[model samples]
Target: DNFLGTLGGPGITVPVVGAAFEVGIELAAGGVEVNLVVDASSEFRTTSNVIANSPAGRDDRVVVVGAHLDSVAEGPGIQDNGSGSAAILEIAIQMANQQISPRNQVRFAWWGAEEAGLLGAQHYVDQLSPRDIKDIALNLNFDMIGSPNFVRFVYDGDGSDTPLAGPNGSKNIESVFLDYFAAMSLPVEPTAFDGRSDYGPFIEVGIPAGGLFTGAEGIKTPDEAALYGGTAGDQYDPCYHLACDTFDNISLQALDEMSDAVAHSVMTFAMTTSAVNGTDKGKGLGKFKSDMEYRGSHLVK
Candidate 1:
């Protein structure tokens, strides 16, 4: 859809590392720094992973938008994560296209072997020095976003009964969805982290993490169906983990709308990351403040 491309760019082919390197070069030239942090001992034994970064400010603090590039043995993983990986890629493209800069660095990660117990993410986080991990502001993960017969859910890492928190001390990093949903009057739902995806690694360390899911191996509840207009008692997303989970299984409407949410969240988080962390005053803040004041004065005038 044209809107999809505009809001989140068209889906690109996501091969392993060779393709990653080609794209990384463009990002480097665009004023965004790029890198690859590999875990040699990872179950996948592949290090073709790509980490693209754009600094909102000069602080080393980062806000991550991540999705796994590897697929499960089941099928091509189009909806499983093709949707997610593509959505994040579109977010990155749009960020570059709009020239929107935020207060903290925004890192886009394409993980590997997520289906094999979140190994790629765990490995990446494990490699982070204690200090590097501390510099992280939050992680926004996207997985399985293209299911047609699915309910939209956000990860509640702390389980606070609030869509914004999960059971542990971890905050509901997914609350950003509520903001965007409210703005667009879209109905939103909350789902617990339950150690289901890449966000698990982040939650393990108390770093807030959140992301969206259409649905997976679980069945849909009558209540969910009523709210979202799908058959209750059926698999939330029947095509999950099957070779049939092709691009056709996706709802273009869902993809178009959700991709917008992804882009907005990434951009919003990037810009407000410093404010949220009380570090907006770090180098980038002065320019941000000046921009805000200039805009504020224009409104007043």
Candidate 2:
């Protein structure tokens, strides 16, 4: 018997259970023969739910930070998302413990079913009113920040280098992270704005959005290895979506740096959306491009 599984969609089949079956071939000096047979079964269903969140005060304007909380069924998904989820949770806890207040409300979200095509984040955005959407100052997403063989990858918000770019104010958001890495004397690379994660929904609605990524199933190049000191030919996270993606799959060094960067971004935006939205002393520096279009190839991880 064979057990097959489909990831994030219908129609695709992958072997998941049962023993390997092979047909042996025997050859005489002039003749050889072999035969094989296969069978499969599948079921599909759909469900819905509300996205959960904890809101801090100062609701007139909002600074949203998010990470997906669920993982693929193939593995525990510790590094694929547990790394981002845990880091954001700690940041939220510390902010509360320190009693840090912000000019704009900070809403931390733990999105669900992201691996199933960003369902959670998209649902949240789709349900929002126009006014509600306009009130958002910006969004910062964090995903897969602890790949064992890592590269410090930031979203290409400005599209200056990559084909994808975010809304009008997104360049400013990217600058914050770029500036931080530069000050730390750390090398960084730009990941395409390919809408592979939760940030997709936010950017689709013209929200100034940016985030961090330490590569995933993508192979690291010799150039990246030279800059980041990891094996050139290996996937950034060899265990991605596999049973080995447990707590032990993470890289602490990469996690520490990324967590700090997350904290810095959260705190910076909490204090002011000036750099992000160009608002000063509660006055707008310029209007946000509500009609801004999303330009990029979608990479559905």
Best by lDDT: 2
List model 2 lDDT by residue over 1-301, tens digit each. Answer: 3333445455666644333333222333336553445564455655544232335545657888999888887789999899999998988788778676666678888888788788989998999899988888788999999999999999887787898778767777787788778867889999888989998998888788888999899999999999999899999999998889998999999999998888877766776635366542221123332211111211111
Q: Per-candidate RMSD vs. true structure?
A: 15.9, 8.6
Clashes of 2: 0
Deviating ranges (above 4 Å) for candidate 1: 1-44, 162-172, 273-301
- Indicate the TM-score of model 1: 0.73
lDDT values, one for every candidate: 0.68, 0.77
Backbone collisions counted per model: 8, 0
Least well predicted 10-residue stretch by lDDT in candidate 2: 292-301
Clashing pairs in model 2, backbone N/Cα/C closer than 3 A? none
Per-residue lDDT of candidate 1, residues 46-116 (tens digit)? 54457898856544668888999877666888888899999999878877886867667899999987876
